[model samples]
Structures are given as structure tokens and as C-alpha cells.
Target: MFFDILPRVGLKPKDYILKFILPASVISLLLLILGITYFSGYTRLVVLFLPLLLMGSAIGYPYIELDSQRQKINERLHIFITKFGVLSITDLDRKELMHLLATEKEELGQLATESHKIFVLIKRWNQSLAESCRFLANRSPSSQFGDFLDRMAYSIDSGQELKEFLHGEQDIVMEDYGEFYKRAIYTLDTFKEMYVSAVTSVSFFVTFAIIAPFLLPYDFVTMVTVALLGFVLIEVLLVYAIKSRLPYDRLWHTGEKPTKIDLKLKKWLIISVIGTVLFTLFLLWGKFIGEIPQIMKIPYQIIFALGMSPLAIGGYFAQREENLVIRKEFNFPDFLRSLGDSVSAKGGGMTDSLEYLSSNDFGPLTKDLEGLYKRVSIRVNSQKAWRYFGYDTCSYMIQLFSEMFERCTFLGGNAGVAAHMIGKNFRKIINLRKAKYQSVSQFSGIMYGLAGGMALTLYASAGVANMVNGLYTSLDIPDTMISIVNIITPEDFSLIAYLIYGVLVIYSIVSGYLIKLMDGGHYQVSLMHFVIMLWVASIVGYIAEVMTGSLLGTSLPI
Candidate 1:
């Protein structure tokens, strides 16, 4: 299987062996020699693993590359097909359609690359379209795309109309895409379970580490650090896994011009930065410089929460913009359908059609639609006008499909048919995103609950350990008993408390990022989840410490 994938990925077997495999083998041998000669004990053992890991990665590089190519191709294959179908209904001939699809590299990525290869075969090699399609199908990495090419090859050979073939393939292709989407969601669910189990186990281990130091001769700081690193590694791996498994979809448009929401986000971000700095300075002063009044004396957990509160402003705006984008995307298909019908009815003037449609309510999309009409009415460059419209709406799907609609209608395609096709696929994609959003919502709730639970357990353990230490210190015990008891000092408990706080902060950041990855939102939006998780951990941790102190009649000095 590895060898077969080489040619498909444009790698020759001889070149692979000489250029990659042989060099990696030599490097591994050198590393093994150095490890045995220079390293000792466990250090040598750790070094020895590097050679094995490197060789294994080198050997598997081809398979990894093949899988990556397949993912890139399959990522946008459904959209590529939908756009291709829309173009097929236009007056474009086979060659022109292939050329146009090949040029859409920005939108279609590897699918467009494959289309360009097919175009090269047809144009340069003078092969028939069916022959080229069949040739590419045989070597395509993605089974779904390959099957599509194979069927398209047969249809072209049998004198079927391209538009008719695509119309028939839509349901079949969409079903496959839906299945692919669901499988990804299931993968995320599995990873979510793994994350919860792994992180919970790590938290318990860290708690054990904190408590065990009081009973055993262990370095409290070193044990906690090791456990924290393990926790971090687990979260990082889960994040990467989730990111790879999720489908590629962007919530925001990537136009060159910044939209009004973008400007608002920028302004709020600056304000957030200034607020963070001022709040942090105030906390520092209260901690080290100023006298704390009775009312101002609060737990450090609450102080940390207060320091991060300013970031909520930026997060709020970002989330609001994302919501607006979703609403615009939802309303876009209806607006497109109406505009298409109007264009056909009025004999094909887009500006007039848009003008008529702009007066109708399209939820968040109405203002953007009106702007598009105004631009077009003033004889703005049609492409630029539509592009600006996409930027204003801030919806990736709307931008892509709107471009398709405009291009097809300009080329004399049936606007109604084109709009219907684009809208159908657009709606399907929206439904998939909604399903993903629901899953992420459930995952977010689980993460928040886990954060609170973890904070309670971790801080309660620390509090109990502190109380035990205090008890040992207060009681008049003999030197022999003192030597046997091995009670941790107040200073040690203080350090452990800070370590627990560190763990909570790290957990909050990682869990927030995981949620953002699943939902395909901006990273700034993760700040919202981050702040909430932090607050949850803080409140739970404070309650646990207070409860433990009241029950045990001792507490760590803050």
C-alpha cells in the first residue's frame, strides 16, 4: 500500500529510498551509536528511543502524505462538485468548464489541482475528456472523488449531458458527504470521552502527588510538575486529533477589506488590553503595596478571575459577530432564490433584481444585499461589488455561493436553476455545521462541569493536607514522632496551592480551545469559554477551601 501511494503522491520509489529512507536510516544509526557511547543509565534509555521514533516516522512518511492529500481533496470536494454543477448549466463547453474549475484553486484547493491535471491531459496530450477523467480517477487518493470521476467518465462517454449527470449525482454525492461529516462528529465524540477520562485521571494523580508528599519523602514540586506536563500533553494531543478529524469550514469571510464587525472587534480588543493592564496593576498593588480593607480581602482565586474579566468584552463582540454571520448565512439562500427568480422574470439585469430583492427582509442579510445593489447600480465593478458584499456579510458560504451565482448568470446560465443548485448545497452544509455546533455545545457543558469538579477535588485535597500539617505543627509531639510523621510545612502547602491554581488555569485554556476547534469559531471566541471556565474553577475552588477549613478548623495561610 505504501509503495502504491508513492506514484500517486508524485514520489518515485527509487527517489524515496535514496533521498528519504537511506538518509533517515543513516541518521538513526548515528543517533544509536552516540546514545550508547555518550549517554548513561536512564538518559541512555531515553536517547535510544529517539532513533526508533525517527526511523518509524521516516518509514511512514509516504502513507502520511497520501492520507493528508486525501484529506485536502475530500475537504472541499462537495463544494467543488456543487460549483462545477452550477457552471455546467452555463453555456461553457467542456474545455471551458474544466479551465474555469482549474482556476478556482483558492476555493477548491486540491480538487482544483486535480482538475488542472485533468485539464492538462485534455489540452496538452490531446486526450478525450472521458479518457482524462478515467486516467485521473485511477490515481486519485480520495475514494469518493475517484468514484465521482469514474462515473463522470462513463457519463461523458455515453453522451450524457454534464448538467443532467451532475443533477443526478447531487443526492448521491451529498449523502456521501453527510456520512463523512457524521463519521467525523463520531470521531470527535470518541476523543471527547478520551479527553475527559485522561484529564480526570491526571487530576487525581496530581492530587495524589500533592497529598503523597506529606506521607512520603518525595519532592512535591517535581511530582506536581511531571503530572502537570502529562496533563498538558494529553490535552494537546486531543486538540490536534480533534482538529484533524473536523471538516474544514470557516465561519468568517476572508475578503481583503475589513467589515464593520471587524472594526468593532479591533476597537474592543484595544480596550480589553488597556483594561487588562489596569486591572492587573490594581491586583499587584493590593497584593504587595496597599493595605487591604476588610471588604477588599478576597480569595486569590477571585482576584485571578477579576484580572481576566476584561477579556470578556472582546470575546463578547467576537461571538456576537459570529452569530450575525450565521444568521446571514441562513438567510442567504432565500435571498439568492428570490433574486434569481426576479432576474429571470425581468429578463436578466442583476442590479435591478437585487434592488427589488433588497426591500424584502433577509434577516441580517438585508442590509448587505442593499449595499450590493447600490454598488452595482452605481456601475461599480461587478466582481468587486459582489466581493464587498461578501465581506460585509462575513459568511464564507455566502461569499463562495454568491460568487458562483454572479459568475454563472453573467455567462448566460439560467439564474433560477443555478440559485436552486447553490442554495440546495448551501443548506446541506449549514445543516452539517448545525449538527457540529450541537455536539460542541454538549462537549462545552461537559468541560465546564469537569473543570468545577476537578477544581473542587484538587483544592479540597490541598486544603485537607494543609489542615493535617497545621495539626501536626500545633500539637506538642516528640522529636521521634516528628521525624516519623513527615508532615509538610506551611510554606510547602502555599507552593502546592499555587500549583493547583496553575493547573486550573491550564485546564481552562485547553478546554476552551478544544471547544473552539470543534465549533470552527475564531480563537478570540475561545476567550469567552476560557473566562467562564476560569470563573467556574475559581468559585468551586474557593468553596472547597472554605468548606475544608470550617470542617477541619485549620487552613493554609494565604
Candidate 2:
């Protein structure tokens, strides 16, 4: 009711300062937002929440816009299906169209998120489905499916009757589409896992942050060692996160190759920042405690500097290589099964059928198979053709299919059975993908727990320092004086045991949350949110240091 009336009021917020010079900030901001909402009758109501609303909308926009777009695309698909009906292509009715739309909405929506490669896959799927439906009406008009291949496509391409020439390809294509959708689901599962990983990491990070610093005086060597190791461990977690989010390389060779040196430099810069922060903390401990010496400090710093450089280079190359392999081999197994089935069912010789079906160019599978047929047609031995298929096909199915063909001499003896087995194994590959996602979730939890635990520990240690310094002031002790309380039992030294215990709890919570996300849920980003816990700990530590240093006349340890 307010929405209908507010829009007609024509309100707006041109300047908050002008509206609130005499008023408080919140009141002025509220009035400005309300004004915007009031005028939204003629526009959008989005301006009302200010930053909060903006944040909410920003997060919600993907679902809302994608769903809205899906409805429009579904409508277009329905209309396209109707056109097939008019032309007698497919016998699919409204129910069939709705079912297709539902599947496509789920499948495509999952694929069409932030990744451009995924977007391409979805668009191609929709385009192929639309084309197939449209073509079915013209090709096999009398089959009760539609005349998609014969009348319409032949008229357009003015070529031979592909439907007649490539008879029985329809069922194979349908089977392939089902397999494609399955892979899409497996990929989407990883997204859900990431959210869980993020949450677990945050809780653990907060706990860790509050407990770290107190571990220092117990053994600065152990303290620095743990802290430095944790930093490297967190970097490894970052790498794992990147891998889970993207199945392939971060750089896809979209255009000219990017400078590898530049990327390596960027990675090193990040590593350097982490190293600097850690080393500085250790240096402060050595000077204050009169414990750290050049022998240990110099070598530790130098080793990190050298080791991190190679890690940067190796990591970048490994990511690129892995992604390229996936990119080249993606879905080749399924494509081959479809080709093999189409060839066998066409009631022709193996070589002829392979030659005929090669026109589809479904993927790298076709090109490699074409090599086998082309060589054999020229009187190359069966082994030669088989070897070519093995050499060119990058998928695991390559060796399996080549062996099957070579043993039978391409005589089509149980090739269908072998292809079916190959297809079955491909389906299992999807399961492997899901399992890796579970592994990623587990790994993310561990890293989050480690980082959070460290942050929390440092925070608590700072607070203790502040209290100890305050004691010196209250007792009117001199700057150089050593308190009996500290000599007998330093607070930092005692806290080490508790901090170590906290690490175990942090790990469990992190792993549990990641398990939840990977299984599926509306989980928040655990890693990013975990940063907030660290920030809070850092703040508390800073305040503690300031209070203690002021009271006891000691400089605050950074």
C-alpha cells in the first residue's frame, strides 16, 4: 500500500548534507532514503536502504536477473517449440516444453554465473537444443518427433537429406545431452562447497587471532616458527581455493599470452608482504627478549626469500598446465560414444560410418576418429589407424577405444559394448569431480582454522602485555625492574599451552562447516568473513598494547 502511494509523492535525495546540516547523520540519511523510496513509484525502490540496501541488492541481483532472464528465454523457447509444432517437426507439447525449460533453467543457471567459460557452455547448450528442436520438425516429419532434418534443413542447406543419410542420430544426440547436464551438476556442487569452507574458516580464525601473541615468551623460537609456518599454510589454502573455484587455469590464453613474469612478480609481492609482517614481529621479539641472534634470524629470512620465489614460478605454471589439459580433454569421451553409436547404427562399414559422422565435429573426438578412418581408407593397417586414434585422443577413453578397435581390426565386433563401457566410466569421472570438491572443502577448513587460531592468539597475548605493563605502573616499579610475577611465570609463556589447545578446536569447526557447505547449504563466504575475526583481534591487541605501554612507560610492541 505504501509503495503505491509513495511513488506518486515524487520524493528524492539530491544532497544529504543540505538535508542534515541542523540534524544528526542517521536522521538525514533516513529522510534521504525515504524520499528516494517515496519517488520510486515512478522508478525503482532500491535507493531506500542506502548502503545496506545496496549491499543486499548487489548480492541478490544475480539470482533475480538470471531468473528473470530465464523466464524470457523460456518464453522464447516455448514459442520456438510452437513453431516446430506448426511445421510438424516435433510432437513435443506444452508439458514437454515446460520440462525442458525446467531442466535448462537449472542447468544453465548453474553454469552461467561469474565464469565466462561456464557462460559459453550454457549458451552453446541452449543454442544446440534450440537448433535440434527446430530441425527435428523438418528432418523426420513422419516419425512423430518432427520433420527437423529433411524438409527444413535440406531446404536451407540445400544439401542431401542428413536425416536420411545420418539416420538414427536423434536418439544418440538425446543421450549425449543428458550426460552433459550431469557434468554441469557436478561442477555446480563445488560452488556450494566454497561457501561452507568460508564459514568454518572465519570461526576458527577469530579464535586463533585472540590467542597467538601470548605464546611468544614461552619460546620465541617456537612462536616465530609456528607463526611463519602458518603464513605459508594460509598461502597454500589460497591456492586450493582458487583451484576449487575454477576447474581450469586462471589464464585461458583468450588472446595474446600474458607476460608470465608480470604474474610471477605479483605473486612474489603478495608473499613478500606476508613475509615482512611475520619477520618484523619476530625481530621485535628478539630485540625485546634478548633471545634472537643473527645466526637464526638471518638464515630464516633468507630461506623464505629464496623458497617463495620458486613457489611463485612453479605454482603459476602448474595451474596453467592443468587447466589446459582439462580444456583440451573436456567431454571427449562422451562425444566419441555418440559418434561410435551413430556410425554403428547407420548400417555401414566402420570406416564409412566414421567418415560420415566426422562432419558433426562434436569435439576433439571427431577429428581424432576421422584420422583413424582416413588412414584405414587409404589401406593403412588397422594398427596404424588405431595408433593414430590413441596418439591424437587426449581422454582416458583413448587407450580403451583404440585397444577395442585394434583387437577387432575395426570389424565392429562389440564396438557398441566397448563404447558403452567407456561412457559408463566417463560418468564415474563426474563422481571423481564431486569427491575432489569434498577434498577442497576439507582443505579450506584446515587453512581457515589455522589462520583464525593464530590471529586470536596474538590478540590475547597483546592484552596480557597491557595488563602486565599496567601492574608495573600501579606498583611504581622502575623501567628496568623485573617483577617477581613475570619472573616466576610470564603470562605469554603460560598462554602457549592454551593457544595450542585452541588450534584443535579451530580445525574441527572449520572442517565441519566445510562439510556442510560441500554437502549443500546457504552458507556465507567463510574465508572472507573470517578476515573480520582477525580484524577484531588486531584491534583488541592494539588497544591492549597502547594501555600497557602508556602505564608502564614501555614502547608498544608493533
Candidate 3:
């Protein structure tokens, strides 16, 4: 509808009008009506933020996409440069070169896709290489990529040696990428401090919100909803932080899939689902049945934690698998260099070289190498065997380099030089990932500390409120002696405790996943952290409740 009306509107900033203004105006109108009639309290508060959230999302979407693509291209820039340089040194004709670019699996996805488009334009439309590159440069999603393409177009137009240009440009690009990486790391450090400060402030706000009702008498439901909105906002910010820093690499697998470990993990995944469902049903039954008040007394957050436990356990195994792949990558470059040397020593025969290298320890990758060698020894097709090895490792780095090695050797190129290139490139990526993880490590600790503090504050607030209210009851004070205030009654205390638990659970889940995201893009890696944080929050909240209750002569209902 907005697209149709956009021309009639004649908005000066058309992008804003088409994307943000129209959609936000519509949502705001709908939300206002709903807030005025059906929604009350916390729901109304959440409704009020919907239009702002929509506007922000519309404005930020393109920037986020561009930033994400930039990081991805940066991650694979070295690989692209190395592969293109190696291929350039080959004697392949232009057609074959274009074919190679279209088919190459090791190159960055954005670069490969754009190269394929340029290749199509040149082949189908008979456009010159320079023209095709210029077309792509203008349309490139990432600014860095556009700059590279522009440089390539200029070089081609000037009739420069493409190989020499690429070789020189590679260093310059790498230097730029290195600086970008350092800046991203710095941004993450800033995010960490901001996370700590925001969380501390949020905790204080929630505490004050919970306790202030005794004096101010705000709607209880609105307070809870406001707290949830705050949490959602924090989560959104964390997601942005993670996306900004995450490397844009696609995970791929080749050949027949599902190793023994894969099968085992699948079963565990099912078990996790079943366990979560059964526990959740049990909790729901207890809550509704009224027969088991004790079950209801068990904090809902604790129930949620219990229900998610199986998934967390399963996630530990998944995380272990991911880590194993990473560890293999750490040793992969050395293995490639060794294989290259051995192959060169054996007159470029890969079979004997693999046999020779299988005896050598290549760390976590040794087992896979041994398997590859054995398969080849048994007269298995070499490509098939290598693909199997790559798939079995379940590492994106392994898959990429394996394909690169296959391409180099298939073209009768110098395998030793190829090995050296792959090794250095892979090492660079590994080091960057390590640095990224290290940057967030301290912030992760701070998150835990904040969770603990939040729990303590909630506990103290509830306890103190109960203690004061109890004295009011014990004194048998006249109605005239007390001002009109919202008393923290038993029911109110129960509800407030539940709200605190809900917020704490949210905080734990968000912080845990954000930390994992900053460390790596793997969702599985975040599970153990989520489980740990949940436990910390629950334990701390429970402990504080018990201690404060004992001191204040008032016990939590649970």
C-alpha cells in the first residue's frame, strides 16, 4: 500500500517515507487504539514501544545488512586474494578463469556471487572485463568490496598485469582488514562496558520499581511489562553488538553426511525436546491442578530452568563438537604444509604423501587424516575420499581449504605453494577469532556479576517491604495513623517474586547467548553458558530470599 501511495506522497526523504514513516505511522495508530481499549497495564506499556521499535528497525536494517556483509567479505578477503592470485598465475584461458570463479567453493560467498554475476554479464552481453567489473563495483553490497572491484576495473582498463595487480592489492586489503578487525575488537570492548553499566542500571531500576509501589502505587502489571520491555531492548542491543563483530562465513559440508557423532547428537536433540516438553507439561499441570501447591511454590523460573536443562546438556556435546572442529583448524595449516611437502617429495603423488603424513600427529585432525589415507590406500576415488574427510571434520575452515587444495592439485599447480598460502590464510582467521573471544571474556564475567547483584537487590527489596508491613500489622496501628499506600501483601509479594525470577531468567538467557555470539556465531556454544547463568541467577535469588527472610522475620511463601 505504501509502495503504491509513495509517489503521491512526494516525501523528500523517500527512503524514510517508504520504509519507516508509513509503516511506523500505521503501527502507532493501531497500537494507540488497542492501548486505549483492550490493553491495560504492562501490555499497554509494551504496546506504546511498538511503533518506535518498528521505526528503529526500518532505519537500521540496511546499515546492519551492509555492516554484516562487510565483516563477511573481510573474513574471506585473504582467501579470495590467495586463490585468485594462484589461479591468475596459471595458464588457464579467460573462459576457464571465469568458470573457476563461478565454481570455486573456497571464496567468500559475497565475492563469488558477485563474480558469477559479472561473469554472466561478460559472457552473455559480450561486455569487456573492465565494464563488467565497474558494473559490479557500483552495485556491491559492501563498501570494501566495491572499492576492490573499482580497483580491479581501473587496473584492467589500464592494461595492467592482473596477477601483479592482485598480488599488490592483496597486501593493501589485508592491512585495511587488519585495522578493521582491531576496530571491531575495540567496539566489542566498549560494548562490554556498556553491557555492565546498562545491566547495573537496569537492576537498580527494577529494584526501585518493585519497591516504589509501596509509596507511589503504580500499576503492578505495568511495572512488570516495563521491566520486560527494558529486557527486550537490552537483548536487541546485544544482538546488534554480536552481529557487528561476527565473521560472515558460511558453514558447508560435502559428500555423504551423518557420522556416528552426528547420529548420536540427533538422538540427544530429540531427547532434549521430549524432556523439555514433559517437564513443561508437568509444571503446567501442577500450576493449574491446585492439588500440588508446593509445585506452584517452586518458582516458575526454576521450572523453566529445569525444563531447559536437557537442551543445555545436549548443547554441551554440540559445543564440544564445534570446539573440536576449531581445534582441528588450529592444526590444519601445519598439516596442509606437511602434506604439500610430502606430495612434492613424492613427485606430486597425493596417495603416498597422505600415507606418510598419517603417521604424524596433526593434533585433533590426525584421526581424519588417517581415515583419508586408509580410504585412498583401499583404492577409493581420491576426490570422494577427500570430500568424506572434509565432511567428517565438520569444520568450515577444513571444508574451504580442502576444496582449495583439490582445485590447486587438479590444475597441476605447485601443491607446496598452495599449502603455504592456505596455512597462512587459515592462521590469520584463527588468530582473529581467538582475539575476538578474548575481548569478550572479561565482559562475560561482568554479566554474571550483574546477574548476581540483580538477584540480591530483588531479594532485599521484597524482604524489607515484608518486614515493614509485618510491623504495621503487629502494631495494630489505627487506620488514621497510616497514609494510603499500596501495602506489599502476601499476594503482592508472591507476584513480585515471580516477576523478579522472570526478569532474572531473561537477563541470564540474553547475557549468556550474547557472550556466545561474541565468541562465535555458533548457537550451540551458547547453551552451556545459558545453563550456567540460569543456575547462578536461580541459586543467588533463592539464597538471598532465604537469608533476607530469616533476618526480617518474614518468609517467602515458597
Best by TM-score: 1
lDDT: worst 10-residue window of model 2: 247-256
Give the per-residue lDDT of model 3 (tens digit) for 294-332: 887776557777777777866778777777877888888
1-558 in candidate 1: lDDT tens per residue? Answer: 668888988889999999888998999999999999999999999989998998899888888888888888877888888898889898998888999999998899888889999989999999988999999999998999999999999998999998999988888888888888888888888988988898889889988887787778777677777877787888888788778777887787888878888888989988987998899779867776785564257788988888988988898899998998898988888888888888888888788888888998898888998899998999848888888888888888888989998888878899988988888888999999898899899999999999999999998888777877777778999877766676675676787788888889999998888787778777788888999999999999999999988998877677
Per-prediction tally of clashes: 0, 39, 0
Clashing pairs in 3: none
> Best lDDT goes to which candidate?
1
Compared with the true structure, what per-residue lDDT tens digits does model 2 show for residues 1-558? Answer: 322222122222333223323244455477566767576653434454454554445344434543444333321221222221221222343234334433433223321121222233335555333344354333221232234333333443554332232223333433443443344345545543554454445434433433443333443325434653464465447435533433221112221223343355356546644755665566655644656566244422232233233333333443344343344345555655665576557653667766776666655455565666788788757676665555454333344334443443243334554455444544554354455556555555554554444444544444455455445446755656542323213444335323432443344334433433443321222322233333333333344445544655553222
List lDDT for all candidates, in order: 0.86, 0.41, 0.73
Q: After superposition, how far is residue 392 of candidate 2 from its true place, in Å?
A: 5.7
Q: Which lDDT value does model 3 have at 145? A: 71
lDDT of 2 at 108: 31
TM-score of each: 0.96, 0.34, 0.80
